[model samples]
Target: MRRVIKNDDSEVKKSNLGYIEGNSNNNLKISKILYKEQKGFCIYTEEYLGRADARDIEHFDPTLKGTSDDSYSNWFLVKHQWNKEKSSKWADYQPVLHPTASDFNERIVYDDGDYRVSELDDQEAINLIKLLKLDDIILADERKKYIQRKAKELSIYGVSPEDFFKILIDDDIKQISYLRAIHEEFKIDIWNLLPNPQ
Candidate 1:
């Protein structure tokens, strides 16, 4: 997972949702805000939030969802399947890195389609990968396919790596999926490739 920098000034952060229960309209608004904040990518899988895939509001600390502690800081947009897979499973494992608070690249490393902890003994990172099924067969296969397709495109005559990297980073063309895996495969640092680097 990539580091997610929450926009402090976002509209959702200005108000409180802790008191509301089953508020669909507010939930939709929050989802839209989070979708934009996350750059239309799922928090866990980094999958593009397109019409074909289902999505959900994932709580980083699920236990806080209905409690007085519920807030934007605990919320994230994730793939529906991942959310279901993670349901009631957090307590059983070590606390994983928080997208908003932790430097993901520092704790975890992506090698092709697999995710492993940068530090061999980091149990939390290990659990994070397992808990989210970051290296599930299906996801890995999709990532492999994407890497091969991009490699073939790169092999075409006159297709410069620089130009192609721009396309990969271009959100207007398409919201990127399996970003860390793509980075590992291409040996590119996506941050430097941003059109207007943050």
Candidate 2:
């Protein structure tokens, strides 16, 4: 997963996020914005959203800290499979990071198209992965496909694998860390900055 910059917090759609809307599709509307943020990717596992894939509206502040779950900043859009797999938890069970508070690029690692903890002993982060099953074979296979396709596509564009990766991170494209994985697995470079976990 990558760090996403949320956009629907714009004043116009503020109502859609909470109190006034009372709409059943409130989550769906939120999903649309998040899809745009993630570039049609899942927030947890970084899987590209396909037509058949369904999204889930997750509350960041499920504990209702100072506000309801529907509160504007609390929302997140994830795949249905992810949502179902990750049930509720209190502070001790919180994910390794939050979109606003954590940088996935720092906490996550990608080599050989696999997302693992940058720090091997970061048990909390590892637990989060296990809880979400982010490294499952199904997701790994999808990520592998993206690695191959993106590597070749960029090669054709005369974009060096290094430049391709820096471009994605610089642009804040969602799942950037995953894209970096593709870079690591495909790149034959004797140069280019390696993925920074700092």
Candidate 3:
């Protein structure tokens, strides 16, 4: 199992990513979604629209007191750029089975007619790998064969079938623990539509 230090700043440099400040406590939830989906990236645009918009300045006033609109705009741009890089890497490695939609827009529309900014980072790559369950799914029959073939085509290192399965099971346990932490810290209903812990 990979021992990821929760406070590791080195990973920050490696991933070169930043997240929305208010959403830091929700990293586990975000990680879970990234891991389980084939696309390897997730967006909460609709969910965060009203809440992050500048028009609802009052909404963010509590958390972002004294923060400028420019700061928020810069964060949004960073977020979009990071996610795109992450998604592109996944596309280059795996089958195109999991396709992600483009969520970047020139202007964001919110109820208040104000724009919502985004944050970005490269740090989630490891978390995303564990979340996408690719380590496990790749061991399954069809997926395993497909991944092996693709790895060979790309001249990439491949995992043993035995190791792949083991990693999957291990990642599942780690993912659950991570999710629990996020739910507890953020007080969000993250498990509502997600699968029950196995």
Candidate 4:
């Protein structure tokens, strides 16, 4: 998972719905803030969340335990499936990387479609990948497909290697962070020379 840059200026507050959400889907006050902060992606998986995927309000720390509704500090936006997988393991494993940390991108490296801890020996990275199954077959395949597609377009269009790297680092394509990391670690140069996507 990438380090999620959570905004300090959150609008959610401690409320009665600490145990679970209420019926009115439109009134998820805190979740609205998190959704905005997360930019419509699962904070854990770093995957885009579309309409068909169920969104879940994940408590980084188990709220059911002694923790009160101070969820603003201990919450995460995850998918329902992932949230279930992370169920009740509050203190069981301390993740090596965190959504709050700003250096997670540089700490963890992605090669092709596999994610592993960097030379820093970030065990939490290992724990998270193992526990969350970040390398699931389909997920890995998708990651590979994404990089291949980008690499193909860059090469096919006769985009200079400089331009390829430039696009990877372009601020307009912040979504390419992970894919860029893959390119860096793999040195993948295959391209299919196609026009840019509209």
TM-score of each: 0.84, 0.63, 0.17, 0.65
To one decimal, what is the Cα RMSD in angstroms of model 3 from the true structure? 18.6
lDDT of each: 0.75, 0.60, 0.29, 0.60
- Name the runs in model 3 displaced over 4 angstroms: 1-19, 39-198
Clashing pairs in 1: none
What does candidate 3's lDDT look like per residue over 1-198, in tens digits?
A: 111112223332345433344674544343333333311211321111221322111111122333444222121111232243344354343322111213322111111122222222322332333333323332223333433453363344356533433443354522222222223333443334244331
Q: Please, what are the lDDT tens digits per residue for candidate 1 over residues 46-165?
A: 777776778989888888878878888888889898999998788887767766656677887777677778898888788777888876888878877887887888797356766787
Work out candidate 1's RMSD over C-alphas. Answer: 3.3
* Whole-model lDDT, model 4: 0.60
| Model 4 poorest ten-residue lDDT run | 189-198
Candidate 3 local lDDT, residue 125:
33
Indicate whether candidate 3 or candidate 4 has the larger TM-score. 4
Error of 4 at 80 (Å): 1.3
- Best-performing candidate as measured by TM-score: 1
* Per-residue lDDT of model 4, residues 28-133, tens digit only: 6556666766665677666656567788877665544335545566677788998887775546667435546667666666655676777647777766666667
User: Superposing all C-alpha atoms, what RMSD in Å does each candidate have to the true structure?
Assistant: 3.3, 7.4, 18.6, 6.9
Candidate 2, residue 183: lDDT: 40
Task: Give the per-residue lDDT of model 2 (tens digit) for 83-183.
Answer: 77666543555445555545666776665766788888877667666666767888788778877777677788787766776666566544343534554
Cα misplacement distance, residue 175 of candidate 1 (Å) = 7.0
